[model samples]
Target: MKIFENCHLFHYPFEKVSAAHWQKYPNEYATHVVAVDTLDRKVLPDSQTLYTERLITCRQGVPRWILKLVDGAQECYIREVSYMDLKSRTLTLLSSNMTFCDRLRVHETVTYSPHHELNATVFRQEARIEALACMKRLANIVEQWSVDRISQKASIGKLGFENVLKQINLSVFHQLPVPSPDANS
Candidate 1:
């Protein structure tokens, strides 16, 4: 198992940051993300927390050393579940790969919250990789490869969010409406 953690600061309020997060796909910074299909979305009646489940397809890079051992495409499907709490100004996301679970699995979680001291929003990400294989030696190699791939994905994901925020700022500056679905709508 491999674990990784990271933190990012966005120069925006919690509301804007949350909005950007929801609209992060279809952005230039996220070329690796091929498709995103929302399987379920709803708001809890009592607390009004938004819940969503999405299946995301992404293309990843396979190390040369590992590619020789196994022959397959680098594309993978991931299941993401998210919860947004408007009252608390917090968003939590959990994601896990749906393909090739017997060989490799990556589970990631992210949390977004308001930064009172900095007057910004903070993003925290944690990921765990499990490489299971019948061969002991192959498992070690796969584990290291998984670690590198997850790191690369995390960096790209952060940059994608930042780009979304920039676009929001630009729209506000030019008096262009930043298009986003209303929470109630």
Candidate 2:
């Protein structure tokens, strides 16, 4: 099976919830920023900017997934992608969803600069690799539980476990060096 599929797992009508309401849940927001630095280094970094209004939040609860569109140039905070909530103890690619708030219109617009295209490519590849690593680690943990016949708790153990993985990835991603512009030019 393909690791990622493009689909709308949930239908949240905008009439029920407005963008203003969704903006409150910025803590659950995640974004991938792609850029090319001076040294021809491509940087695709994922981050949750709580202080910045650049994220889209869920109107009712925390979003399960956020879809970020990363092209060579122009990064836009598009919409919240919805996913299916399986409530499974183990994290599976099938159980995630990205839901967008009703009021926000989905548009196709690239807002980044073309000058840093190379850096953007590198960033995206690195970030994706890091995310995959985290997912693999979780899969390994789940496999261990299965082998031990341990019952996983959806609320506590699984979520907590995933959070730990995410923290580790973030820490490592932050430490990556940004290339100087002169080197690329």
Clashes of 2: 27
TM-score of 2: 0.19
Cand. 2 Cα-lDDT: 0.25
Residues 96-161 of candidate 1: C-alpha lDDT, one tens digit per residue = 988877667789999999998987999999888877765466776677767776677778877888
- Cα displacement (angstroms), candidate 1, residue 151, comes to 1.7
lDDT of 1: 0.84
Against the true structure, whose lDDT is highest? 1
Candidate 2 per-residue lDDT over residues 1-185, each given as its tens digit: 01211111112222111121222221222222232122121222442211111233312211222222111222333332222112211111111112221211222111111123232110000001012233454444333332232122212323342344445446668999988989888
